[model samples]
Target: MQPSIMLLLLLPLLLFSAPSISTAQDFDFFYFVLQWPGSYCDTKQSCCYPTAGKPAADFGIHGLWPNYADGSYPSNCDSGNAYDASQIGDLMGSMRSKWPSLACPSGDGSTFWRHEWEKHGTCSESVLDQHAYFQAALRLRSQVNLLQILQNAGIRPDGGFYSVRGISSAIRSGIGFEPGVECNVDDAGNRQLYQVYVCVDATGKRLIECPVLPTSKCSSRVEFPPF
Candidate 1:
């Protein structure tokens, strides 16, 4: 599991746009994973990557942001006991380096604590501008689930998990691949549990399902989280 601070750091990154991915349908890995409406795949790249990247496996926090480093992941090509814990460590360090001012750090500015700007408090407009930055950070931390799933499934050059995406209500209701599921053990010795789903919609924003509470909308237009 990621430390609470690192997860907080990624909030801003979720609020913004990620780099574009080429989804030409011929020999493109993305072709196997992304699902979208209509022929829009030719022009719109928003829902292409993050949505496609889901279901490859139940990556932990990485499930939130699949477009990291141009979308080719498990760059080390090692998995299982063969996996490198050091690489995961490197990812943590690298993320902090890329966005130091974000909420990945402990204390103050933590995502667990709402920003004064979010609260419309004493902070000025300039401070409020930072909210976009925090949202992006949140999105990235949410992708941790992808990394865990990749490692758990031993994804590699010779063999790896395969993910496919489609918007059919039938598909979503079937027993096929699930994009945003995460694994977590209960502290009280209960069985592991499946967390919410995370994904980007056609509008490129984030969404979450509380089931009991109303779905919380994120800054990006089409993103959605695990239910």
Candidate 2:
């Protein structure tokens, strides 16, 4: 056999056997983020309800993102494993309700989910495979009633502005840990309650106090926009 032919034939085998590149898998905690649907839709870019129809009038799962204690995070840790919705087929009903996508162009929530899994979920694959990751987030979402928590604290999302600290206190009262409240400006430039970041153990179970939080751009009061 010619040397070139031998090299060409052996190339496929070498490529197939190449070592998988290592990614930063170790992480300190998770930001089990829940987003307000109304705030999400009221932004300048706007949003589209899922093809599964409108989600419930409540906070929904944004992601279960892995992060370092220093506030740094990991992402795209598994290029080899893309999000296969079939892996989480059984969780669709819950996902459609608890994690609906409101981004354009319109979608059934898969694109949003795929972006989350690939960017955030993949970093935690060492602990939870795709199915477990999605399931665990749903479980966490079920455990906390964010809307009820705020309402109980007299912070209704009736397009009324409320103290940011008070909102955090309400969540801590309900869930036993203070949460990080993030806000965004609406189309009319009103700062609205956007996402609530709660920390979780590395295993994606049980909420914990956040080690670091997204810089809160909220004022003394932020609008809890109506859905």
Candidate 3:
């Protein structure tokens, strides 16, 4: 065989034998979502108490969302690892106290939690199982006391609009890293403080800086609606 022809044949074999690139879903960090009660339940049409009852005036947990460094996130990555409420029996009390669902016609908060676990928790199985995932979120919420920190900084939730810089600064000072602040406009066309998201390491242990901070739609002045 000619040397050039032999080389061409070998090239095809080599190319076909190379390992295929994987499309398996993986995550880098977590977004611990905290929802402001006032913002969540502002409109009569939007508010609904859970079977467990209404959440306190404090911020209620939204979810511990798994996210990529490129600002994308994964959801329902593994349906086989479906959420099991029985598995989280021990965490019920803490979840009720800290992570209650404020959606309408709430049914013991199971639906909300199930949705979160299935969507976000399934993506974190390698780092934390079902129990650990919920527990980590609860612990993070307890550690990052948003209300108290803002209170100390004189930023009360008294239906008053505050500067975006001031709100972000208070959270950054409290948690050692700047967070992604979200806001929504109320019936009065006023931008109300909504959800606050903080990035957490994959192990669900440490709070880390977000590779790509979430955009805040809030204007220069946002109202911290009263609970």
> What total of clashing residue pairs does each candidate reach?
55, 0, 0
Q: Which of the two candidates, 2 or 3, achieves a greater lDDT against the reference? A: 2
20 Cα displacement, candidate 1 (Å): 14
Instruction: Give the candidate order by descending TM-score.
Output: 2, 3, 1
TM per candidate? 0.22, 0.88, 0.87
Taken over the whole model, the C-alpha lDDT of each candidate is 0.27, 0.91, 0.89
Put down candidate 3 lDDT per residue, 1-227, tens digits, no spaces. Answer: 99999999899888886755443547989999899989877753577788877778898899999999999998898889887989999999998989888877777888899999999999898878999999999999989999999999999999988998999999999989989999887877778899999999888989999888888889999999888
**TM-score of candidate 1 versus the correct structure, residues matched by position:** 0.22
Q: Write the per-residue lDDT of candidate 2 for residues 6-105, one digit (tens) a residue.
A: 9999998888867554434489999999999999999888888888778889999999999999999998999989999999999998988999998877
Better of 1 and 2 by lDDT: 2
- Return the candidate ranking by lDDT, descending: 2, 3, 1
lDDT of 1 at 150: 37
RMSD of each predicted structure: 23.0, 7.9, 5.1
Which candidate would rank higher by TM-score, 1 or 3? Answer: 3
Candidate whose lDDT is highest: 2
Scored against the true structure, residue 156 in model 3 reaches a CA lDDT of 93
